[model samples]
Target: MTRPPAENQELYRFSTAERWVHRTSSTLMMVAIVTAAFLYLPMLAELVGRRRLLVTVHEWAGIALPAPLLAGIFFRSLRADLRRLNRFGPQDKGWAWRAMRYGTRAAGAAGKFNAGQKLYAALIAGATLVMMGTGLLMWFPHLSSLTWRTGATFVHDWLALLVGVLVIGHVRMAMKDPEARHGMRTGRVSPAWARREHRLWAEEEAEKQAEAESAEG
Candidate 1:
């Protein structure tokens, strides 16, 4: 038996667990990426003179970074939503094209997610996978030949660069939508925010809640 959802409430969007993981993961990734960059840059390395600590930070960050995503899988709703984002359908592609037109021509309508968002998800996932792979190799260098370790080093560094660039764009987009940050920060967003940015998701949630209530009643 299910109870009816509060008719007009802006209940929590993210759970405490989700918020903890999101903030920790984001912070660790930022630290890892930035410290890693400094380690690679000759000028910064000369100034810091702490290559050992930077490498240590990078290695540990790689270990810490995947925890949130890994833990999030236990939350079925979040995992399912992630899969939806992972798969970009025909309409998604169309949205992308329309968004390009909107940006370039400034005359057309745009859909919920533009092409760039879809591409960002793909690239981010790719970079994360690469990072995990190379990081594992780096962490357990004794298991690999010298040649493999050398190759892994290059791959790891390059993928970190890609992740950094993609994440900056993600941050910029989030800043443009103030409510988006509030959603993660407070685990809730304004009703209008959901209706405007993700009406379909909101509608689906509403219908699901309605059906559950009907069954219980």
Candidate 2:
């Protein structure tokens, strides 16, 4: 069988809808984080002033954090990717073990999202839900007991710190991987990069392409 031209071989890693959803969610999360820092840090809060404004922005950002993902439910590509993120297979376990053992160097043959990416996605999702829930209680103190409100504040403060670290680490990793960053930015990646970073997913894509071509012929 004849292969397609090299120019036509770029693999689609993310769809437009997927990119938009990610961009939206990331922006909101960043806004929430920044505003939270201004609200919590005494020196920064004193310099920034406008406590009410910061609080409003932080609350709204938190409230709208899930909007993009909820809206993305209508997009088939995003839904498919969500399903992929939700599953854990044998390869995922192998990938996870290597990641734990060797840190970032353990990147090997894996699906579209390796175990680390999947774990990050899961953590972000859970953290978002927790943040929103705790945030809502704080925003409306009348909605909960004093004990509940105190507990929410404690959980919210600690989780915010954890998420800040996670986001910074995520950004640093992306900065080190230009091709992976390009895939997210442009929704496509060079076939060579895809093959090197996600061999199993690259092979699956090639198989699908071949099957489509055969049907056409």
Best by lDDT: 2
Residue 138 in model 2: lDDT: 92
Worst 10 residues of 2 by lDDT: 1-10
Candidate 1 lDDT at 129 equals 76
Report the lDDT tens digits of candidate 1 across residue range 103-187. Answer: 5123222233335665786787678778888888888989899999899989988888878888897898789887878888888
User: TM-score of each candidate?
Assistant: 0.78, 0.94
RMSD of 2: 1.9
List, residue by residue over 16-55, the lDDT tens digit for candidate 2: 9999999999999999999988888887888875789889
Off by over 4 Å in 2: 1-8, 103-105
After the best TM-score superposition of candidate 1, give how far the Cα of residue 1 lies from its true spot, in angstroms. 24
| Residue 87 displacement (Å), model 2 | 0.4
* Collision pairs in model 2: none
